[model samples]
Target chain A: MYSRDEFFLLIEDLSLLPAISPSCRSAFDKMEDPEASLIGIGHLIEEDPGLASRLIKVANSPFYPYSGKVGSVREALVRLGLETTRGVILTTSLFDRIRGEAGVYALWQHSLAVSMISRNIAGHLRMPYPDEVALAGLLHDIGKIPYFMHDASEMHRSISDVDPGRPDYKREKEAFGMDHMEIGEHLTISWRFPSIVCAPIRWHHNPAKSPEADRTVVRIVALGDLIASAYGLGHPEFPFVDGDILQLTEELNLLGAEVTSLLTDFLYDRDLIVQRSHDVF
Target chain B: MARMMKVELATTEDGEMIVQDVHDMLGRLLVRAPRRIDPELKRMLLARGIQEVFIPDQSSGDAEYERQIVEQERDAIRKRFSRLQDTPDNKRIVEIFIRAFEVFHAEKGKIPPV
Candidate 1:
């Protein structure tokens, strides 16, 4: 059994590790400023030419809804909005950190799929902050990254043995002495992300247990995770849909017909979405 | 001219015709008939995680007809769920799916008809 202090130390070690580049970090920090203009945010991104170029690529990529190509960082920022821009920046940075690791790319692909699906579900339901939920979906499994960094093979083995029919959280806890949700929540909290985002990361596997106020968003992310898994987008270890998915959908007031249509849409779009994920990541 | 093709059962909607016996992943025969597909069968297929089944392919001369059928099904499904669309939560989900679909089409060309 791992002590709580061990988990805290893991977080501390992760904090000390070289994760995001300084320029990306600065760009993220600047995004928090209400007074920060698009140009200012653009310039901060420009400091890291690679990130700027990738941001433009993503902005023009099939992910964003816009038609025309975004030619510059400023245009990308204006098109993507602050929250999605932050998500893009963080995703790119995190991808850089774990680019070549076995299974990491696949995990990122899964995360991106979940992010897109979460945003879709939230927007369809007219949630107040869909992008925040998207961000949560993107980072929900982030706690696994530290474990991969520590021992990729061990982490891979642990997840590979998980029973597909059950939620992987308990297995994760048993294997690593801390589940990904706990580690993810702690990390996101330390990153200063709002509770709206952090709570979903912590409770996405079991949305009914989340605080009543945050339940909707948490359920959306949870559904997104399930859909992404169902579509075979990312990590294969936890591919089975949780039995509670239908119940959660009902609680969120999504109609059976809506769920059917959504599943149809996903079925038709799965290959292309998987392809887009590979291209983006 | 029509031929038979193995397709994922989950992708088959109600009214489609199955051409052979459907079996679960464990090889247990679930449905044995050249039967017209229905919602209950689809649900049972999905429940067992059965990935593929043989189906009659009438997509030859009636490609337009097939497309129309798919569109109608999609439309009916949408209308049924339309009441939820006005809410912020459902709206965001629809917007995201549309955006993702648009992007996929733009980047990879149109997805071929299933």
Candidate 2:
């Protein structure tokens, strides 16, 4: 059993740990500038031809769903908005980093589903920052990526052994001395993500325990995660819905009929979601 | 003009031909068509927690009736939940779900059901 400190050391030593690409980092920084023009951000992204091409690909993917093809990074940035564009670049870079690792595809698929669901939930709730919430959903399970990088077999075993009735984090803690949420929280903080985004990644499995300011979005994300799990979107080892999820739904005042409709819609959309995930990953 | 109906997978017997291929939520093909479902396949579907499969009703393919069913369900949902105070949050959430569903339906329509 690895101690928490030892696990941190292991993460440090792992070559496959997620690092923002220099070009992406530069592009993100440029976008952050209050006076940065769309053209300026586009130029920075174009500096990395590979990232530029991927941005265009993702922009054209179902997630964006433009009537016509996105011809350049500028078009993608304009259409997807700065935050979502940054998320696409970051997500693609992260996927590239862990592409061949066992279970990466499954994880990516799960993340995409969660992200889509989160955005939907946020949209439903009329939240001001739906894109940010969506981005948070995409990165929620990212902590597990390092484990896959270090020990693919053990990670696969853990996922396979996941019992839906119990929190998967507890099992992870017992095995590795820390859960993916904790690792993800740390990683997001290092990446300088806002507290709103980091909070959901950390507290999604247990929204009631989140900080008061962050609870609403956390609850939204938690519900989204449960919805994705219930639909068996990605890896199936995790539980779909539990007591906490039920309680959260009630607290949110989501009606049973609404939930049923949501499920029906999910069923209807499952195929397209899967196809989009493959395209992104 | 497709009407949705639920088909129980548990009650399906061996040698019963599957009219359409069944897929899981992730869109992975669970059972292929042109073949009869056997005990093993049934067990596999059950183990995956798939209790039922929803398919288009072949007998009455009335598109308008299907649309009415959907509208009625939406109306019932609205009425049942209407007692709760209306808030921008709730309205937005419902709208988002609706939009998401529309996108899904449009995209799904473009491809043949597997």
Candidate 3:
């Protein structure tokens, strides 16, 4: 097994993936700056016509409450808010960069399911930043992308193996000396993602280990992941097992009645949400 | 004393008290139940593009909706999860998933499988 430092070296030496584009990274940094204006952020996003159009579509989606049609990037930026707009730009840019890689479509579909479910749970609980949670879910499993890009024989022997009784991460840890969560955490940190986005990526599988401030959102992602897997929208090899649902509810401190109510809402909207997930890409 | 019935929001009649909470497509609560169906509530639901809500009905019985929803999904879920160990947690999960599916469909209109 390779040491953690060696893993990083291998990733860099083999060119497993490229860093975030300089232009997108600069725009993201500007959005984070307190001195940045809405017009200024708009101008930066407008420089790339493709991103600008995608931002408008995301703004007009039913996720946001604005009734009027969004015509301009500036207006879309205002509608999405800075944090959520930043999340959108980051996720979409990453998704764009990884497009056409083998097995990316299935992976995207699973992420979309988790993203939609997580957002629904966030809204049902009246949590803040539901859209940001959606983006977090979308990017949670992104550490697996490098495996997909690795040599075909290695990818098949490691990631594609179906370990029926164990969690997916344990197998990944055995094979690569790091689980997907750890890999994901490292990648997001290198990309300079905020804690809100990175915490779920790292802690979703074991939410109790997350900091108190981020525990609830991490629990939401865990539940969303379980539910998605239960409904056959899960990752083929690493699906969360049966007891995970109960464990997560306990971690969230949800009483039996509350769990029942929350799950009823999830069941009610499952099909509609699943249908909407397909529209993401 | 009457059974609850799921009705399209646009067609709900006057004086029909909602028997359960009304939620939108995303599962956010709109109005808590045991409340009267007012024009204002209807307007709000319409504004939000909601299509249905559970209202008290004199014609059909309450048991049918729950039974139907559970029956439609129970076997399929059990088959899908057959590989899981037959523990209490797994059984409860299957039950909760199917039961919640029943409750939600009984409250709101059901979406048939595609």
For model 3 the local lDDT of residue A78 reads 82
- Cα displacement (Å) at residue B72, model 2: 26
Candidate 1: stretches off by over 4 Å: A1-4, A162-166, B1-114
Query: After superposition, which runs of candidate 3 have C-alpha atoms over 4 Å from their true positions?
Result: A1-3, A10-19, A63-67, A150-153, A156-159, A239-243, A255-257, A267-269, A273-278, B1-76, B79-85, B104-114
Give the per-residue lDDT digits (tens) of candidate 2, residues B1-114.
344555555444477666677765456787776557777666556444354555445544455544543443344334323433466756644454444444444444532221
Tens digits of lDDT, candidate 1, B1-114: 357666555446788888889764235688886888887676555434344577776565545544544444344323323434255665444444444344433344344523
TM-score of 2: 0.69
Q: CA shift at B81, candidate 1, in angstroms?
A: 24
lDDT of 3 by residue, B64-107 (tens): 56454355355545644666778898788778776666667667
Q: How far in Å is the alpha carbon of B77 misplaced in model 3?
A: 3.2
Q: What is the C-alpha DockQ of each candidate?
A: 0.04, 0.07, 0.12
How much is the lDDT of residue A133 in candidate 2?
A: 87
Tens-digit lDDT track of model 2 for A1-281: 56899788776643232376778878978877999999999999899998888888888987654588889888988888887786677767766776765446656777888887777767766789888888888888878877766666666566556354545677678667789899888877766678888999999878878999989888878887766654545443443334244467677777766665655555555556755666766
Q: How many backbone overlaps does candidate 1 show?
A: 23
Per-residue lDDT of model 1, residues A1-281, tens digit only: 34556656866766543588889888878988889888888888898888898888888876565788889999988888887787677657766766665456667777877777777778778888877887888888888787776666666666555354545677667666788898888877777778888899999878878988888888888888876754445354544444355566788798765775565555554655655755566
Fnat per predicted structure, each in turn: 0.00, 0.01, 0.26
Worst 10 residues of 2 chain A by lDDT: A234-243
Give the residue spans of candidate 2 off by over 4 A: A12-20, A32-36, A65-68, A162-166, B1-114
